[model samples]
Target: MTQAFEGIRIVDFSQVLAGPFASGQLAMLGADVIKVEQPGVGDQMRTTMANNKLADLKLSPGFMGVNANKRAITVDLKHPDAKEIIHRLLADADVLLENFKAGVIKRLGYDYDAVRAVKPDIIYCSVSGYGQQGPMAGKAAYDGAIQAVSGMMGITGTPESGPMRAGYMPADISTGITAAFAISSALFRRTHTGEGQHLDVSMLDSAMTIMSPNLNKYLATREEPALVGNTSPTFQGTANTWPTKDGHMQVSVITDRMTATLVQALGKPEWADDPRFTTSQGRVEHADEVKALIGDVLAAETTAHWIERLGNEGIPTAPVNSLKQLMEFPQLEHRGILATVPAPPGVEGELTMTGAGFHASNGEPKVTSAGPRLGQHTEEVLAELGYDAAAIQAFRDNDVI
Candidate 1:
């Protein structure tokens, strides 16, 4: 069946996490995404060694994660004739995406205005550290920097840890997902207005947007929440992790009724009537006592025992799973979050990649192919753009592509 974005074409001039991630989403939805990278070197993420998985995949885990289901080609954007190649690609594309340090795309002469001059209704998106203009516009940024600046790090981890970053880079991942949503919205808007616009996606802005709920609470109460580890500030001990006989298990009691269920599950039926942990507010106020009481009881059993026993009582509980353990989870198979694609050059068997999470009513998301090697599609793409042997050789001689 034809997918949601079957006929849409995207000229992806982005790299690393945020930009490639956005275009990769388009590719999954059946858009034709052509990834443009610097000649020879390619994306720096291509070298990211994600636990020796690169050997079997021929690309780094980071690159493979975000770059599947798209075509890749390299062009020397610094070369004078490079502008000709970029505009030629944009001439028929529906969207153009780039993430450069501030003022760089414009300096390269393919900013929104220049690209729009080629395709009148193309959606142009720019991702950067900050918005187009601000005090920190020129500052170099990555996941950790934005996490620190946006107060995400401050609110995460434990008091003893003192402002630790999240286990994974939420800033980059969230920004990429948000940019895809924005581009999708813009595509929908074009149906009505017959117009296209430029999108300025700032990683800092994306970080702050995700922190809105906590920020709003702080603003209303004028009180900063404590950084209690493994527990949400809103509920404290109610949604926290506890040590078990073997490993650890996470539990959450959202309502007063659920607290009673947890109490019974812990074999402390009398504590269900105790005022110290009766309500959500009370649990937050006496979090230390509540955590200690539950921790003591939970330490008596293995994670499997608690998960089954608590789950039977309708209490939310789960064992803390390592990456390797998660890979063996049965739920993932049912959900189809993992898929296999043909391996890229040099890699042996079929390569697995994470699929787009949601299912469309008409068709499910797909990963058509594995990640591309540096400029693997360069010759084929250039030939399709009407570059014959002589002109192609001339570009090669001049290092234009």
Candidate 2:
């Protein structure tokens, strides 16, 4: 079966996380993505967090994570011959994804207007921190900065610990997912309108949208969310993390039925008849008392024991898994969300990387190859642009590609 983006081609000029992640999603679904990078330096992420050996090979685990299923080419956009080459590539391209700071792409002469001049129906997507035209446009931002500014950190930790960013790159990952959705939507719209789109995806905007539940509460009630730490927004004593004999386990006994099940699981069915623990509101009023009771009971049992006992009772429960534990999770082996691809050059065997979040009936997301080495397909891509061998060599000598 044909994939969703089987015939689509993208010129991806994004790096680091957000832009590359967006394009990577399309590539996984069969878009022909050509990742354009500098001649030698390549993407900053290629070596950002890599160790000495991986950095020397320009194959950082972080880079390999998002760049699978794409080709790589080098180009000096500042070089005079660059325009001709880019025009050739754009002539048949359906999408252009970039994450440069606002005005940077324009300064390099590949703004939407110039690109539109070449491919009138091209989907131009620009991913940035604050957006294309704003008071904070062009300002430098990273995941941590976005988290702090987006109020994500403010509501994350306990009041004692103050604000804290999430352990993962929520802002960058959310922005990438948002951009991918926006680009896909644009493609869908173009089918009927036959007009291209300019997508301005902002990490800040995406973060705000992701926090709509908290933001909407503030908007309606004019109240700020408190730092609750591992506490559920429902404020129910039964919906919080507790220490077990072996480890930490989180539970969400939201509804009365679930709470009853939880109490039964704890061998405390008598609590169900108590007035202070009968209803959801009653539980909230006696949160501390109820929490202490649950904690005392849970602390006597092993995490694995409760997982099985409470899980069988229909209570939402999970153990806080470390990275090692998560990687070895048995359920993940069946999910197919992790793809095993051939190792990049100099590596042996296979490398396991993440793919799409969900599965499909057909044309499921996959990684055909590991992320490309820097400029690994420069000659091939240039040759496809109608550049002869000698012309390609000349561009290399001139540092134009």
Candidate 3:
């Protein structure tokens, strides 16, 4: 079966995380994505987290993680001849993705209006720190900056440890996923209206959306959220992370039924109906006592023991796995969230990266090609665009491509 974006063509003029990640998702769904990068530098992520070996190869593992299934080409957007090449590429393009700060694209002469002039129905999606129009529109932002500004940091961590950002790039990845959805929606709308529109996605906005529950709670109650940190929202001490003999286990035994099952698992079924620990209100009032009791019992057993016993007893429980432990998890293997593709040229062995988060009936997400080498398909793509060999040579001589 054909993939969802089988015949769509995307001109991806983005770098780092958000823009490339959004285009990468569509590329996985069979869109033909042409990654436009600076001639020598390429994407900054090509060296992010790279050692000497991968850096010299210009194929950082981090870069490949988000950039699967796309072709690479080099272009100097400031060059005079660059506009001609871009116009040629956009003549038949279905989407144009960029992540430049606000007004940067206009300075480069490829703003939505200029691009729409070439492809009337092109989906022009721009990912930025704030948005296309705002007081901070032109501000440069990184994942950590966005996480702090979007109040994500404020809501994370414990009271003692204070506000802290997540270990990973939550803002970058969230914005990428959000931008992909917006672009997909724009494409769908174009099918009906036969018109194109500009999409302005903000990393700050996306981060706030990811923290919607906390934001909504604060808005409705006029109270800031407390940094509970590994504690369930129920505020029940039984529904928090507890240290076991071997590792940590997170349990969410909030409801009366689940609490009863948990008490049985701990060999204290009598506590399930005890007046001081029976109701949700009572548990909250005696949270410290409940936490001490549960912690003492859990400390005597291994995390594996609790996982098996509580899981079988229908109490929501899981081990707080490390990244290494998580990779060995059997459930992930069954779910197939990770995808393995052949390594890019000059690299040995296969490369495994994340695939689509969900599955589909027929046209499931796929990675047909590994991420490309820098400007790996420049000549091939230009030739496909009907540029003759000498004309392509002239472009190279003039530093245009």
Which portions of model 1 miss their true places by more than 4 Å? 50-58
Query: For candidate 3, lDDT tens digit of each residue in 1-401?
Result: 88999999999999999988899899989999999999998999999899999898889988887889999999999998899999999998999999998999999999999999888888999999999886998999999999999999888889999998899999999999999999999999999999999999999999989888878988999987778787776678788998999999998877777777778889997897886577888777787789889999999989999899889888889999998999988899799888888999989989888888888898899876678999999999999999999999999998998
Candidate scoring better on TM-score of 1 and 2: 2
Per-residue lDDT of model 1, residues 327-360, tens digit only: 9877887888888888888766888879898887
Please, what are the lDDT tens digits per residue for candidate 2 over residues 185-246? 99999999999989999999999999999989989999888787887887888789999999
TM of each candidate vs. truth: 0.97, 0.98, 0.97
Q: Give each model's whole-structure lDDT.
A: 0.87, 0.91, 0.90
Q: If both were scored by lDDT, which would come out higher, candidate 1 or candidate 3?
A: 3
Clashes (backbone N, CA, C under 3 Å), per candidate, total: 0, 0, 0
